[model samples]
Target: MRQRPVNLMDNPHADRVKRVAQLAGRSAVRNRRQQFLAEGPQSATEAIRAHLGFLKLSEPAQQMWPVGETVAEVYYTQRLIISHPDLFALVQQLPAHVFVAETSDQVLQAMSDAVVHQGIVAVVNMPPHSLQPSPGAELVAGIVRVQDPGNVGTIIRVADASGADYALATAGTVDIYNPKAVRSTAGSLFHLPVYTRVELGTFVASFQGRIFAADGYGTRVLDQTDSGMLNGPTAWLFGNEGQGLNDDELRLADQRVAVPLYGLAESLNVATAATICLYSSAMAQRRQDPSTS
Candidate 1:
């Protein structure tokens, strides 16, 4: 029998409500439940799109999925009507199995960690992608111990927009799934393949593509980068926010390329620097084949 939309407003302390809310704070809850809360309309839209193959890397993690469990669910506040037409329209396109529940404002707050809720949250059924590179993936981004979650999320967005094949985050980098990080992504989290908790040195050693380390004080300026170097597969390495890439890490890359600072600015934001680096590789790759460009 098909299920009907349920109204859940009475008990704010119900086990389900409490459990879902805990997802924002506890990684243990997310792992055990195999469901993470995507609070607000932006995350909801992206989480739904992930169901539609926005998450290409997730497919390989399906072995951990329980049997007969293709269905997913979404919850929202019926009383708290939002004027976001685009968000609602995206929700409507999802399959019928994604249940929508009507809840009160108090309940919505309990289910979200954000200071403000957009009256909607989607319970995304997602699996953790392993740190394996896809075949024929040329352009890759490597992130070191960038502790800031917002920077981590925004870098993923930069990778997605710059046509990077995938992103590999080494150990010590912030967890991509952390609620604050997820919120900062603004849906770019679901757009590209992201593999986390990797060993930077080990991965760099085996990478067949040219590795361009992003160093502000490096010898070669980005504009001076050779066209031939960009034509081949490439990997861009990014270091932490405070201390940049260590000596050992820098030695692993094929070349250390810096983005020239014309003005008096001391440095570029990690995400902004990464955006420029990724796009540089992307543009060069496209120039190698302009018909498709």
Candidate 2:
């Protein structure tokens, strides 16, 4: 059958589509080096329909956006509040966006990291954490000298799931909104607050809780601490993965603890150690909690 070649004009919106593509493709329209996109609902909808990958859906507002099958990830939450559950329900099923943000547009925009500020942003929720520990809140995590976004986000997730409270990242730690850190948190960034400080020594001094450092050759064993002083409100300190803790920082700790490693590996990753330390405290606290007991 000899038929006329179909014109893209037959699609009617072809020109508009081409313009949108041009806008999306241009570096200025997207973002340049060192600049990222903080998209709003308008941008999110556009991207969802456009099907761009690598967008890590964060918290709160991201949780509310509707996503298509082309989404890179969708991290949803039971904590999300919506007047239209059915509408959001559809967003939940999509595979693209990581449903993490709250319902506010302004917040979503603030958390957005891209240069364009897509109006809809990926915000990792840092739940309010108190210095004062609850009866059940026995475990604590602190970040010292680590400044990478990936490291911080990974540590935050490990700490939260391990049931740690009051994550204290020292003065040198990366800003939580560095995009890379927020993305690394997965959906766990929405779980707890990580405190940033201008001074490491003074910050730990102010912390009234028990302090322990995760060192390779420390005098104490992490596994044994569960039966010892770890049962109390404890803060587990993690040093930079490369340099470990400085001598001055080590002096600030009430105890220097080590994770028992039977394997040939030299030491555990700071994030992984943090998880172990936090969960150890959490398990002890859970066992001690009057209600749970």
Candidate 3:
């Protein structure tokens, strides 16, 4: 006989519901709690997988896990449990520390920042900021003071797709955990290591490889830069959307590389520029060392 699932929460105003909703709007709350909301089916699914993967690690490995326990709680509407039984099954695999609850549609809506809640949300723990990339990391994508949450998230996704070893959000960049940013990641948040609130100068000082600044006015155009330069470990730094990299910031990079523009468009979006620069480095690196591809 199949056991029926019960709705564990029905009140939209419940304390638990409000706590989850607060994570969406308040950075202070998120920082103090060290948790953020992963809303909608995709984010929830990826988070669940990350949590389960963590459980499979050996004890010592678990203790050293780069991204801490990925999910702390999961809330889903009855409609979702019925429509997404597979997702529900994955939720059931979560450990005892993870709170799993079934909520009414209204309750789920109250807990989500999305206009359409998608019937699911997961409270995910933030990864520790202490794990710096190894000196051998092949590629990294860094954003400095990029204000748009969507652009930040999209750049993270593009970095993941291009096989960058890590994504970095320097101080003043929009919160990567912002609901819009999380949604824009389309689950890539769980795919790669994303370090936030990094210090640009500190990172530049510690990084062993070349740092390429994505500048609109640079001596070296990206397409014409020496392929050998792109073949090694590299970090691409992108700046704020409107101003790009300021003079002082550009001085830190080993090279300033511009994406050649054919059309009359004045500039490329930060995320778009990041995609081009990252893929260029990724393809070049893979071509040089096929084993990494």
The TM-scores of all predictions, comma-separated, are 0.86, 0.57, 0.92
**Per-residue alpha-carbon lDDT of model 2 for 106-207, expressed as tens digits?**
333233344443323322122222222222335667888776677887887787677565466676665554555655665454345455553666656666
> Over 4 Å off in model 3, which ranges?
1-5, 54-68
lDDT of 1 at 74: 69
Best by TM-score: 3
| Candidate achieving the largest lDDT | 3
Clashing pairs in 1: none
lDDT score for candidate 2 against the true structure: 0.53
Per-residue lDDT of candidate 3, residues 1-293 (tens digit):
12334677999988999999999996788888889999988888887877777334323223323333778888888788688888878887777667788888899999989998898999988766675555557789998999999999999889878988778888788888898999999888887777778888888888989999999998799888888999988999999998999888999999999999989998899999999999999889888887866
In angstroms, the error of model 1 at 61 is 10
lDDT (C-alpha, whole model) for all candidates:
0.75, 0.53, 0.84
**After superposing candidate 1, which stretches have Cα over 4 Å from the reference?**
1-4, 52-71, 79-82, 89-99, 129-131
Ranking by lDDT: 3, 1, 2
Rank list by TM-score: 3, 1, 2
TM-score pick, better of 1 and 2? 1
